[model samples]
Target chain A: MNIGILLKEGPYNHQASDTAYKFAEAAIKKGHTIDAVFFYNDGVNNSTGNMEPPQDDRHIGNRWVGLCQKNNVKMMVCIAAAKRRGINDDVLIDCGEITGLGNLTDIAIRNDRLVTFGD
Target chain B: MEEFDDDEIVKKIMHVMRNAPHGTIYTYEGLEMILIMAAYDQDISVAFVDDGVYALKKGQDTAGIEVKGFAKTFLALDGYDVEKLYVDQVSLEERGLTEDDLVVDVEVISSAEIGKMMTEQDVVIQH
Candidate 1:
């Protein structure tokens, strides 16, 4: 199965980003191909390289970068939403690429499933 | 950016508005997404439920709230070829509103009906 994920909430403040990561990891383990993870709303915050959690805590942004790198999945943040929240290329993680909503529509069309994780 | 191909499959995408227009940016950003998606020539529909019903109510003046009012933007959706707009009947009555209270035309339907429609959609994005 080729699945696309739409994540719409920020990390730490909401459990949405965490659950989305777990779901993607489990899906990959089950032999499914993750087509892409498109972040909108505060979900773009998950692409920030500036985040520094406690050594004992999970680093949400790094987790996404690592997962996408290991599995060869595309990580996209909506350009319009990103700009509204001050997320630009300078602060974006390596795995995250700023894109447009048309890509989201394309993701919906090409993927077998388009799942949303948000408030 | 990749150009949208006319040969690509047209998706049935529904944007579900579940929040009030103000006090948060969800509804506003959701609208921005819809406007962009509409240009792709996909089949798009919008459902206003919960406090989202208030977004379509007539005479929204944001001057006092200090936020730019986007209520009129809903009216311009038709120009983008996005004409399928649904309003929750129960939500309207609960808020002491009717179809007449809305600034734009929308089909007033029951939540169950909307649920059935949602199942038919390829992508249902809720805000």
Candidate 2:
């Protein structure tokens, strides 16, 4: 199964990012392929590289970056949304890419499952 | 165009509406998404839960709010082959609304049923 995830909230304020990450982890563990994780709305914040959580706390952004590195899953943040939120390419996580809504449309069309987590 | 069949390549896509109609674009854009996906020739259905039931209220006059009234736009969905509409029974009752108060026709179902149906779908997009 190929799964596409849509995350609509940022990292700390909501559980959306955590849930999406866990869901993707479980899916990959089950031998399913994750086509992409498309971030929209405030979700674009997940791609920012400037986040600095407490030293012992779980690093949400790094977790996503590692997921992309290990599983080869695409982490895409909406370019327009990112720009509006002041998340430019210079601040994007290393493994993530800033894309457009057209990529989201393609993700919807190609994936076997498209699940969304939001507020 | 792609082909879809109930027993074959049919994709069960459910658009879950969890936001209100006004104050934000989630509901409006979600409707647009459903309308677009409806034309894709796939098996499509809509579920209304949380504040989403408010989107179907009978007398929504957004004229005062300056936002274009899209409540009536939902009524036109049936013509585009997007007629499968379901609302969460708990959500409706919690909001002090009944089936008769809605502008369009919808099957008032339980959240359990909607949850089970969601697990079975090939795609579940929540807005």
Which candidate leads the pack in DockQ? 1
Candidate 2 residue B104 C-alpha distance from true site, Å: 3.6
Candidate 1 ranges with C-alpha deviation above 4 Å: B1-6
Real interface contacts reproduced by model 2, as a fraction: 0.26
**CAPRI category for model 1:** medium
The digit string of per-residue lDDT tens for model 1 on B8-74 reads 5777889999999999888999999899999988889999999999999899889998999999999
Tens-place lDDT per residue, model 1, A14-111, is 99999999999999999999999999999999999999999999999998999889999899999988998899999999988999998998898788
lDDT of 2 by residue, B44-113 (tens): 8999999999999998888898888898989999999888999999999999999999999999999999
lDDT of each: 0.93, 0.86
DockQ, in order, for the candidates?
Answer: 0.76, 0.27
- Name the regions of candidate 2 deviating beyond 4 angstroms: A26-30, A54-56, A79-91, A98-112, B1-9, B22-26, B62-69, B76-80, B89-100, B105-120
Report the lDDT of model 2 for residue A99.
77
